[model samples]
Target: MGVFEVKGGRELKGEITPQGAKNEALQVLNAVLLTPEKVTISNIPNIRDVNKLIDLLKSLGVKIEQLNDDTYTFQADEIDIEYLTTPEFKEKGGGLRGSIMIVGPLLARFGKGYIPKPGGDKIGRRRLDTHFEGLQKLGANFEYDSNTNFYKTEAAKLKGTYMLLDEASVTGTANIVMAASMAKGKTTIYNAACEPYLQQLCNMLVNMGAKISGIGSNLLTIEGVKELHGTEHRCLPDMIEIGSFIGMAAMTNSEITIKDVHYDQLGMIPQVFSRLGITIVRRDDDLIIPKQNHYEIDQFIDGSILTVSDAPWPGFTPDLLSIVLVVATQAKGSVLVHQKMFESRLFFVDKLIDMGAQIILCDPHRATVIGLDKQVPLRGISMTSPDIRAGVALLIAALSAEGTSHIHNIEQIDRGYQYIDKRLQALGARIKRID
Candidate 1:
């Protein structure tokens, strides 16, 4: 296992370029299986999950060539469908939750798809019934094999139909959209997840000749065609990474600038952070954050304590709730951080509380953080990462602590952030990655 030993009490300063969106990159790469033509992708993040997906694609006979460090050329001209059923492929697919999406595209184009139980951040119960439900609505038949815990889908020809998802699950919506893009007729998806990542997937489909209306809204109308031709598309900048950087700068009292942010796509993230008294100045494609005193938590009109919560897109994302919780530890007043989407996400607060943070874990879903306001610096301590987002949160806490801190199980952090130690080192943060 890898570990990050962070020497704390350093103000991170410098310009850091955000990497491509991990969520968007996974869906876009899987979409390559929908066509035989060459697809060139730029700004790809070099993360573990993406490398695993790339290896999975290579095993399936997708020819991937590296044009440069952050660009790749992919051609799924002669995919070996049998490769997907092997133990190696199944094990790789089981490591990434997003890999389940390949089942839809493979089923739509090749008549059948097989997938093992998917794996990801163990934050809560992630149901694949939504994916199967949406695909079933589009004429796909699903079968589960108890012997291997594998799910298979088969459909001779998928016919478009209207689907109202049980919940606006992000990956579920992406799966159905990719499958429906090559179906027989028009497909209307209601109550869909319209996060920026999903919107990028929709836009990529449009670029590939699939007709998708309502790019950034819940109601998406996709007019399925016989086939989709491959086209070159650059993945969007990662909003989650951008938000993480913002939180890092705020908590450490650092003046940093994030370059090449897709400002328009980051709908309400800036405003939401502003409620916590962190001001972000947008200059063209860059977002600049200045050092300031402790953040002030905004209150409701009735003078009640403010509650920052997550909902589907056009609302705050649950992925950033951990960053918000960590940032709130340095703020002035109390704020309720509710993560309704995931049950175990707030359980990591025990580690933060041990560092002298004034946090009250209301339950599995909510936490109240009373900020330290620069009066007391968090002392460094040894900790274990429970999940991806919480691991990053603990890393942030460790970086801002007063002494050296060791964070074990850093593979959780590597799953999302690409070369995080080096990236932070460039910004004057003393983080060393050791095995």
Candidate 2:
């Protein structure tokens, strides 16, 4: 674990670029396992989770070549199937939640896949029922071992069929799609997640010779193919990172431009922030959040309290609600942040509350944040990050606080973000990394 000693109240000024989408990159990287040819992927985020998946693939005897700083070519000509059921895979695979995704590609190409219990942020009960359920509908026999907590799937030849997912789980949808692409007959996944990350995965698969329709919609149709070929894919800019930077700019009262955010793709994020009275100017594909002395929270048309909650795609994402809650600290008036997805995500407000922000945790899923309105800056304190998004939210709060704040357990932060301290330093913020 490491600590970030953040000296807050600095006016940051610069243009920053968001890294490649981490979620999309995870799915894309695992898709390379479906083909034996060389698959080149660009704009891959150099974060811990992505690196861990790459390392796991390397252990399976896949040929990997780093093309550049943010690109790599992976060829899965040979794989060690025996390695999947070993204790070492249990240890290494448990290191990341994305490890479960590798099972999809493995099953698609090898007719069998095994994944030990995967690990990730402990924000809530993130279930893998959707993943196994969908793959099961595709003619895969899935069994869970209670003792070792591993999921093993085997199928001689997968025959696709119709499936309506219980929830539009993003990773679950991606997993099923990768598996279904090589199955026999047609696969129809209704209520599937249609986020840009999933769309990017589908697009890349289409380029690799998979037949898929409904690129940006919830219902996806896939006609199984015998085999897939090599393809090049570039991950889009990280929308979550872009939103985090925007929140940081607002919290620190800085003028910042998040370059090439792919604004056309951000469904409701810009407008959602605008509701907090944060003026976001769109310049082509960039988003500029100017430093402001004061901004007022917008009430509902009924003059009711403003409530910013999370929903499925085309709605505000649950990932950005934490950033929105933190950014609301210095805005005028109050707003209710209903996380909806995870129960423990809003609990991070306790750290912000300790920093002197007026926030009330109404329940496991709701928090009411009263804006400080720049009347008083938050005072720094020592805290630990509980999860990935919360870690970034706390960092933003610390960077805008009145004094030096210590944030420990930043390994959670490192898993998702790439070189966060260096990126903040480039924006003229005062932050140091210490062990």
Candidate 3:
């Protein structure tokens, strides 16, 4: 495992170009399995998760050629279905949550697919019931083995059907969309996840000859086609990174400019951060975060602490709540950070508290952060990453600490942020990745 060592109290400054969205890239890569023709993907983030997905695809006989730093040409001309059934494949497949999505597409194209339990942030009970339910609605039969935690699905020809997802799971919505695109008739999806990543997947499918209506809305209508052809597409800039940079600039009292933000895609993030007393200036595709020495949390009406929570698209993202919680420790007033999506995400607040942050973990899902108001800079300490977003939150906390901090399990951090140390280094952040 790798660790990140950071020397704190430096104001990060400079221009940073946000990397491509990891979540969107994962879906885009999996979509390539639907066709044998060449598919060119540009603006891909070189992150750990993305690399793992690429390796898995290659192991399944997909020929991939790297065109440049952030572009790749992939042709799944031949898929080795047998390779996907191997124990090695199951192990790697189980290690990533997104790998579950391949089951639907593989089953749709190959008539049968097998997948072990998928791994990701140990946040909560992330159920695959929605995915299985949606696939079953499209005429797929599934068998599950509890001992091995393997799920197998078989369908001769998937017939499109109207399905209402119990929850708008990001990956669940993605899997159904991919499966429905090649089904026999029309598919209607209600309560779909309309996040930017989902929109990107929809657009990519449309470019591949699948007719999908209601691009950015909760209701999606898909006109199934005979088959999808290869198409070229570029991923949107990572909004999570954009939000992280915004939080970093505010906490470090730094003036940083983020480039290629895709501002329109980031619906209400800017305004959400502004509630934390951070000033953000939008310049077309770029976002500028100005330096701030003293920042106060904006309270809700009735003179109480402000509460920031997460919701589905067009709402604040759950992935960013951890970063916002860490940033709140430096603000002037108290605020409540509610992580509604996950049960255990707030447990990491103990690590932050040990660093002199005035945070009260109300429960597993909520924490109250009382700002030090620049009265105290967090003392440097050694910590281990729990998950991806929390790891980034700890990195931000370490950067704003007093002396030096060591963060272990950097692989979690690498799972999302592309070239994170290098990108933060460019912004004058003193962080190094050591093995």
- TM-scores for all candidates: the values are 0.98, 0.99, 0.98
RMSD of each: 1.1, 0.8, 1.0
Any idea how many clashes model 3 has? 0
Give the TM-score (vs. native) of candidate 1: 0.98
Candidate 3: Cα lDDT at 154: 87
Task: Estimate the overall C-alpha local distance difference test score of candidate 2.
Answer: 0.93
Best by TM-score: 2
Backbone clash tally for model 2?
Answer: 0
Model 3 bad stretches (over 4 Å): none
- Worst ten in a row by lDDT for model 1: 291-300
The per-model lDDT (C-alpha) reads: 0.90, 0.93, 0.91
For residue 329, give model 3's deviation from the true position in Å: 0.2
Q: Let me know the TM-score candidate 2 reaches against the reference structure.
A: 0.99
lDDT string, candidate 1, 63-137, tens digits: 999999889999999999988778888898888887898988898899888899998989888889999999989
Candidate with more favorable, higher TM-score: 1 or 2:
2
Q: Rank order by lDDT, top first?
A: 2, 3, 1
TM-score of 3: 0.98
Q: lDDT for model 1, please.
A: 0.90
